[model samples]
Target: MNNRDEPANAVPRRAVLAGLAVLAGAAACSGGPVGPRRLRIASSAGDLGAGLADLVNRHLRDVEASVVTPMASAGTVDLIARGEAEIGLSQTDLLGVDASVTALARVYDDLLHLVVPADHPITTVDDLRGRRVSVGETGSGTAVTAGRLLAAAGLTAGAYVRSERSLDNATAALTRGDLDAFFFSGGLPVARIRELSARTRIRIVDLSGWAGALRSTYSDVYVVRNVPTSTYQAPPSATIADATLLLASASLPDALAYDVTRLLLERRDVLAVAHPALEALDVRSAAATMPAPLHPGAARYYRSVKP
Candidate 1:
C-alpha cells in the first residue's frame, strides 16, 4: 500500500523498474567499457610520431591515443607544454629545460642535411652568402639548428635571402629551381630526399667542420655524423646530428607514464618493423635525456628493468 504522505507526482514502482531496465539494455548493447582515457601525441606528419601513436592505440586497452601532426619538432614541444598533447616527438636541441615537459625516451638521432642542386657552385656554409635558402619552416627544430650552424659559420641573417618551407615544399621548390638550398634534419635516409635525389641530381653540403663551433655553444647536443654516399648517391659527407626525444606532459599519472614507457621498450622489436629508426632505442641511452629529466613514472620503469 502507498503511504498517504507520498507525493501525487511520484512515479509508480513498476514504471521506475521499467525505466531502469531500458537504461541497462542500452548500456549492454554499447559493447565496450565507458569513458576510456584519451591521449593526443603531437609530431610531424608521416614521421615517427604517427607510428608511435599507432603502437599505443594497438596495445593500450584503457587508453585511446591519437596523433596530432604539427610538422615541426618545436611545434610538438609547444603542444605538449600547452597541455594540448599528452605526448610528443621532438629533437633534443628544441627541448630546453622546461618543468612542464618530461622525457620518456631518447628515440633516435636526426642527421642534418644541407641539400643543393648538383650543378650549384655553393660548397661551404660561407658560400651560402647572397643565395636563396630555406632555413626550414618557422618554429621548426630544423630552423633552429640551421640558424645556429649558419651563425657559427659567420653568416648572419642578412648574409642570405631565407625562405621558410617544410621538407616537402623545400624539395619541390629546389627541384623547380626556385630555391638554391634548404636545411632538413631527419632520420637516416629521409624518403622525400631520396625521391628528390632520384629525379634531380643533388648534393649534401659538408657541415662536419662546423660541428665543433656548434658544440662549443650548445654543448654536446650537437655531434658529427656521416650520411653514406650511397644513400643519396651524393658525395660522402658528415653533417651535424642531434637526438630525437619522446616527451610527455609532466602532469601525466605515474601509472600511465610507467605503462607507456614499458610498452615502448618491451615492444621495441615490433615497432622497429614499421620504423627502422626505433631499432636504435636502448634503455641506457634512452634514460640519458639531458636538459629534460625523465618523468618519474618513466624512471620507475627503467629501474624495474635494470639488469
Candidate 2:
C-alpha cells in the first residue's frame, strides 16, 4: 500500500533543504561521490566521546559519521591532525599543542578525579609523595592534567612511584589494592567511578587549591569546580576542571563545518538522550573555545544565530 523511493528512515527533505542553502557548491567541488559525505569522529573507545560520535551518526543523516576510537584524547587530536578523522573530541588544554585542528563547540567539562580508597589516610596532594599512583595511560589527557597538578603540588617525578594504565585497568588495580591512588579526568557521574564506588568505598581527592596555579602556568582553560555529593555517593569535593571540545580538522570545508555546527545546536535535545553530559551543551557558551580558535564555519554558524 505504500510505495516510496527512499527508505523509511531517510533524512527528512526539510533537513536536506536546509543544508543545501549553505552547501550549494559542496557536491560539485568534492571530487568524491555525490552521496552523503563520510565523516570519521575520533575519540576514546568507551567514554563520552564515543557517545557523542553515536549521537552524530544517528542524527546527522546528511553526513555518514563513524566513530574512530584512538583510546585517548591526545590520540584523537593526532588522528584529526593526520587527516585520519574529520572530527574529534578532546580536552581544551590539549588544543594548544596542535594547530591543524579547530574547535566546533565547548561541549562540557571534565573534572579531575583523584580517586583513592575511602579508608586511606591520604587527604591531599602532598600525601601522594612516595605512594603508588597511576597518572593514566600514556598520551591521555588525564596524564597531562594529573602530571601538571602533581608538579604544581611540588611532587616531582621521583617523589612518587608512578605507573601508566588505562582507566579500567587503574580502577581494577585500585580495587585489588595494587595502587594507592589513580587519576582520571572525565565527566561527572563517570560510570566506571560510580560502579567502583558502589562495590568499594572510594574517595575523590580535592584539587581546588591548584586551580589558580594551573591557570597561571597554563591558561584559563583550567577552572575550579565541585563534583557534587550525589555523583558517587561521596562527599562533595572541588577539583580542577577542563572543557571538552568538539573539534574539526582545519582543512574541513566551511560549508560542512557550518552544517555540522548547526546540527549540533538544532538537535541537541535529541542527542542529550544518548549521554546526559550533552545536556551541558549550551549555544551561549559553545563558541568560547579559548586557546584553540573556532573553525571559521562554526564561527559563521554562531554569528548567523546571534540574537
Please provide, for model 2 over 28-67, each residue's C-alpha lDDT reduced to its tens digit, 9 standing for 90 to 100: 6785466787788887866555555555677666677778
What tens digits encode model 1's per-residue C-alpha lDDT throughout 130-227? 99999998878889999899888889888899899989999999999999999998877788898999999999999999888898897678989998
User: Which window of 10 residues has the lowest lDDT sum in candidate 2?
Assistant: 47-56
Q: For model 1, which pairs clash?
A: none
Best prediction by TM-score: 1
RMSD of each: 5.7, 10.4
Q: Candidate 1 — which residues are off by over 4 angstroms? A: 1-34
Worst 10 residues of 1 by lDDT: 45-54
Q: Positional deviation of 54 in candidate 1, in angstroms?
A: 1.5
The whole-model lDDT of each prediction reads 0.87, 0.85
